[model samples]
Target: MTTLRPERYSATAIALHWAIALLLLFQIGLGWALEDLPKGAAQFAGYQFHKSVGITILLLSLVRLAVRLFRPRPEPVKDGRAQMLLASAVHGLLYAVMIGGPITGWIIVSTAKVRLQTMLFGKIPWPDLPVGQGFHEPAEVLHGALGTIGIILIGLHVAGALYHHFKREDVIGRMLPGAMKSHGVIGIAALVAIALGIGALICGRLLSFAPANLVTPPIPLPSASSEGDIAAPMESTAPEEPTAVVSESAVSSATATPWKLEKGGRLAFTAEYNGEAIKGSFSRWDATIVFDPEDLPGSSISVTIDLASVESGDSQRDDMLRSDSFFAVGTHPTAQFVSSSIRAAGEGRYVAKGTLLLHGQRKPLTVRFSLNIDGSRATASGNATLQRLAFGVGEAEWSATDQLRDAVGVDFNLKAVKKAR
Candidate 1:
């Protein structure tokens, strides 16, 4: 008793083969589309989906290989020796790419600069490869090279199948999903076209997928300024026609000098993202200062910042920062600080203790600043460090400080002129 060779592959093998093939084409298209997308929540989700598909291809390819080994397979087409060798080489390379591509991609995510956890389809958490940082760049290069090779091999495989279905008329029927006979030339062309079109359509749909349903409010556009001034000056002149009855009781007893903020003032911040500095600035803010260097008890200062006016040079990142996960500007559009006390620290340095209201949280803050007065014009610069998490700026998964650090540095520079009585 002997086992007779079959004319068609086992149903299981056929299903896996077609599944992996379709996935490979779709994956390649997706990889290219990822580069075109802006850096934001939408792109992040797209990448996760790409990873999920790659993992799926790897599992299915492994199962397909197992089936080929244990189960009886169709006899190979008795073609020329050269054709047989070509087919064998292509098949071997395809298998290598199918397995290696996803592994390299996993390594990339594991050792990424910004280590984000891979969530499969935003549901199942996939563990990263146990790898180190230096592996990321090489793996990325290798992954891209493999994708290029895979595309070329797939084209060759498709061309071979079409040739056999037409010229040889003996090879393609074994892999056909069902008893689907070609009606004519139109039918054969249609079959090939469908195979090609499926992946493109899938890729297009994935690229256009909408982001999480979080409303990102529009930031008010700041007025234009010259290169010398980053922030537009917030100053207005008094009207000449105004005449009112004198009210000496309304004025304060302390005769502290009022300083008007001049142009070229800047309010900037720096935060660490994966050990890299992300620099940004608030374009809209106002300050009130009444100070006397000799009379610290009579001096005071206050600041109000429009949080929605933050610009980090990245539109997507700016949008994300304005969203609920971070600043949540829609809920708390402004942050204010009112000084409780001011003391002279050194010859030119002063420290102002204040209460800062940010992200709906109020906390004590100490600001150290250096002041220089030249006749009536004055210049001041200061810096402060604040914990973003403490103020409830980062919510949910974003609250974790591994990717984005907790401590953020805020710095400001301003020029002012004394207001006449």
Candidate 2:
């Protein structure tokens, strides 16, 4: 009589099985963490990461299903018809939840009112499905329902595996690698840990918690004088205009006279969060211009912006913006721009090619503006688009371009008075 060999699953099938299992666990934990986070950069990042991992799971599950359809699987263990039917039903349900959960999440993202993109691992751009915003709430409800179903199905799957292993059946061993031995105690213990983790997550004990109140102390005012009287204000002096002789020369060599930013100047940027536009400004920034519209090559400009001075009207969101995951003000407190070249674009329009150093990264930037000079006073209005990711402004979880866009638009309206030579 010839000896018969026991069948085992292919390496690909086994690999996919374990990969999906681990990823699903991670996804579940991430989902819990995401829900626990308060609405800010941390929560925003958690949501993106959760979506990324869910998408990964979705892709892997599809591949696993495809592989199962095309490749051979281990023969079913010898068991009663009822037992076989139970096993098949359990597996079918597992696959359904695994695939359905991510699809529901995708639908939610696609239909969300806020236009958000999905980035795979914070690098590859993943587009949302072509779905209308009307479905967002419905899809969100479905996603939550699927998640609950997934937890139950996972529990049943683990119980079934334990039942087979404790009964000394060959089913569990068929999925294990040839080099590894299967023990009922070890498998049951692992399942118990997973069960406890799931229970803790459901009970809101892990990672999820309400945010504490954040207090921002008021800035201290200058102390009163020893006599208990406030200091007198300095006498104001009006800016002196260039003399007629100097003005005549400046008309020829405009680069010889420097320009001072006037009181009405404004610098602002627009950022998108959750499909809404957020407008902010750097309250403290200075610009030095040595320019002559007549001398393009000789003119130069330098701008220094205090990152900590950012104000977006919302205190919580402002604090989050200053956190390490976004601007990282503690490490890099200022951003700068220095002009390398200036060229006339049209009659009154000009383009300044420069290098912007932001968040410790330097990149070439161009600002286009139309300048109007009325003798001694000048005005410049311009806008530029900046890619936040290029400068590492949004770090780690904030790196997702879908939730927080990579492109930020900067606009400035500067009124400057020309200084005498």
TM-score of each: 0.53, 0.52
TM-score of 2: 0.52
Q: List the residue pairs that clash in candidate 2.
A: none
Best by lDDT: 1
The candidate 1 region of ten consecutive residues with least summed lDDT is 222-231
All predictions: root-mean-square deviation over Cα? 14.4, 15.6
Give the winner by TM-score.
1
